[model samples]
Target: MLGKGIIKGMAETARNFLGSYVSAERLTTVQYPEQRIPQIEKARQFPFLVFDGDDPMKGLRCVACQICEKECPPKCIYIVKSKDKRVDYKGQMQLYPATFDIDLSVCMSCQICVEVCPFESIKMDTAYELSTTDRFGGLMVNKHQLAKSNEHYRHIHPTDAAASDAALAVEVAKAQAKAKADIEAKAKAAAEAKAKAAVITPVAPKPVAAT
Candidate 1:
């Protein structure tokens, strides 16, 4: 019976060997590279940031919170902040970042930067075609090099880009509404305080009771 089992297994192997060469009738391996393979939706690849198309620089959604920098397993991101020099709505000068850099050589592409960004400023790119002659200088990408338009982002990851845009819009609307409500509440409280202060109390004459 043991010998019969071995013979049966060998017979199956022989059949498969013959089946592989059956050309049109065979279920066989696919040719790679020349014949492309479809990628799954959730596949993780090289990381890059998504930008808003309208205003390229301002669209950097990153508020320079530095949470990504601190959380990075590798210290790949380098950021330098300078005075914004732009006048705010209150006519006051604001301080903002002047320079932001990321060294791709050190980057592990862990997607942590993309994950932790509260502003949805950054996301992992699907592009895996990075090859260069020089490893040290050529690999490290600066802000200018790293920047990509929102249109470009949509082209690469349309579904994710759309979702991020929607989320950002909602956040902005909520912030604006909350700010407006706060301003109105403050104004109402001030008016009520003023009205209460303006109330005049009648002075009772001491001789009124005697009269």
Candidate 2:
């Protein structure tokens, strides 16, 4: 059994090597700089922020919560909470990040940021062609650079993005419904208060004319 594992591994490698000649699908190795494999759907390489609408800043899903920055293993992510808040796509006001940056050089591509993000603001991207001469400056990505549209997320991870969209839709509906209910309750209360005042005051004018 000492050499059995090694032999099995060699056999598998040999089989794959021989199989590549006959089957195009079996050719797993791609010659870099020239030949490239089609990007797989679930292929994740780095973390990115997801935004909903066309404007990255306004549509940013992150509320500057800093949960991901705190949870990040390498501390590559940095966020600065804004002083002011703006209404989000879901009709909820949220604090946008004044400064959001990520040092890709330090990031290990662990995807922990994606896992811990509750706001669906962060997700993994499949882009791997990140070569740059200016390593330091180029690798330091800001919020504007890190922000990607929801459409890109959907294109990369259709299933998860679809689920996220569905959840957001449900939340938006619930918020709208709750707002409507609150308005109705306030209006009903005002009407009832007016009626009570009218009843309490009583008509004093009936006996005043000829008494």
Candidate 3:
């Protein structure tokens, strides 16, 4: 009975060794660069900017609010507001970023930037392959390199993208409704003004006839 514990450990090891060949759950090793496992939906690496349309510069959702830059734990994000203001996707006037940069070398991927962004322009990316040879410039990702399409966002984070789209739709509907109400109110005011003018001028003709 002295060697009984060792015998049981050996048996367990043999069982696992056999299970690795037979059981799908036990087969964990994958061929790197050839066969890759499906990426987890919630897994995230660095952050990327989300753009709406085909043109990354024109369609970028970032209004350069600087909230993300201010809130970044590592201070990896940098933004410069454009000299000329531009309209955003919601047709609201806002200042776009003239330059945006993220230092990947210092970035901790804490997702704080994405969380603090008010414009929903930034999101955590699933891409992890960021190996580089050049130490000076390769790690510094600029706006052009950071910008990614909304379609790509949907592809990577479908649930988050759908929720964002829904929220945007709600905002657009509210803006349209407010505009319609303003137009109706103006028309009503004009009609009232015209009616008042007609009513007040009518007595002049009657007075002339009486004379």
Among the numbered candidates, top lDDT falls to: 3
Higher-ranked by TM-score: 1 or 3: 3
Superposed by TM-score, candidate 2 places the C-alpha of residue 138 at a distance from the truth, in angstroms, of 1.5
Q: Per-residue CA lDDT of candidate 2, range 1-211, in tens? A: 6999999999999998888887999866688889877887878888888998788888999999999999999999999999999998678788999999999899888988888887888999999997778988998999999999999999989998999899788888988999899899999999899888778767645556566
**Candidate 1, residue 87: lDDT:** 34
TM-score of each: 0.70, 0.81, 0.80
- Estimate the overall C-alpha local distance difference test score of candidate 3: 0.90
Badly placed stretches (over 4 Å) of model 2 are 1-28, 203-211
Write one digit per residue (lDDT tens) for candidate 1, span 15-89. Answer: 988878785557545676577566655555655555554655655555566778888899888777665554322
RMSD of 1: 7.1
- Residue 32 in candidate 1, Cα distance off native in Å: 5.9
lDDT of 3 by residue, 1-211 (tens): 7999999999999999898889888877898799989899988999999999889999999999999999998999899999998888777789999999999999999998887777789999999999899887999999999999999999999999998889778888888888789889899899899888789877655555656
Ranking the candidates on TM-score from highest down gives 2, 3, 1
Q: Which candidate would rank higher by lDDT, 1 or 2? A: 2
